[model samples]
Target: MRETRRQTFDEVDLLLDNARLRDELEPYRDESIDPSINRMPLHAENEYLASMLAWERAPALPIAEWFNPPLDLMPPDSLSDAQLSSLLNKTIERLFSKNIVLRCTDHLSDRELYMIVYRDILPCCEKMVDVPGKAIEWMCVEDTETWLRYYASAVERRRYQEERGMPLPAAETPPYRRQLPGQ
Candidate 1:
């Protein structure tokens, strides 16, 4: 008869415990407690875990401190169209340099985007937590309905529709398309 070696359940349990211990030793071990962890698919969970790990190790800085020269934005109401345009362009460049990016900007006009930069973003005193390989996001503030209608993914739109118990209005593309950073 041939000799055979079989693994016991206790041995398997020991192996699993070792694996769990290794995961706990990782930088983002605490992120395992994220409520959506179980709901996400394997790949998405992996990505999220990686992002969480990066965030855990990254340095935190205020938005004002992120820039070397510091920002000098004019008040929205005081700027002419040409001045606003020039400032907006320069600001966008500066934001991109600092790994900050705008999301759902396609829903807003150029003027609206500039206004947001002048009013909401420039004046805000929030600290940015920088994660490697992740760009800080500035999403559209006004006209959320328009963003949801045109820019939100199909699944999000469907969920919104279901929650409201009414059909959503058709998506219409915005008149202007501002190129987002790190496209």
Candidate 2:
């Protein structure tokens, strides 16, 4: 009789199991998931869970280091409207090229967005890990008081009242809209 060269049924099952485990972990093995974690015993039963645990334990890095070239932004007030607009366009393009998208761009006027990009985002050294399948988002990070006072729509203000159980204050017109760039 010819000697059999086939894997045992149990061996095939183990191989399939390992493959499934790897597939489960595949989405988490990106740049944001620190590679320093031990990934030995490729056939471990809990490999997927281990990878997630390792990611949770990884040290965070500053957002500035996440970019190939660090952002060096100028003060919004220092630039003329024309210069600011030009720089804002270039900066937005640069950020988009790096998979860093600005959220709520449509909600903000040119000057508001420009101030946010210059003062809050560029100067921010916060750690913002980018997980796979999720875009890095930059948005207005102003205080709730300032946002509610200036930018919150009537609907948003009412929603905030219901959520916080606070008495709804009379909506005051934002004084900055008159000075909005390109207005």
Which candidate ranks first by lDDT, i.e. highest? Answer: 1
**Candidate 2 residue-wise lDDT at 31:** 71
lDDT of 1 by residue, 1-183 (tens): 223223455455555654454485475465455776658655455556556555555555546556766786777678888887787878888988877787777766667888787667766655454545767688764665776777878898889888988778787776667776677
In TM-score terms, candidate 2 sits at 0.48
Question: How do the residues 1-183 of candidate 2 rate in per-residue lDDT, one tens digit apiece?
Answer: 223424465567666866675566677566754454335443444454444644554455544455677777677788888988888888777766545677535546667788877767666654443344435576553567556766679899989988999775565555433232221
Query: Any idea what lDDT model 2 has?
Result: 0.61
| Among all candidates shown, the one with the greatest TM-score | 1
**What is residue 50's positional error in candidate 2, in angstroms?**
9.7
What lDDT would candidate 1 get against the real structure?
A: 0.68
The parts of candidate 1 lying over 4 Å away from their true place are 1-62, 126-130, 142-144
How far does residue 120 in candidate 1 sit from its true spot (Å)? 2.0
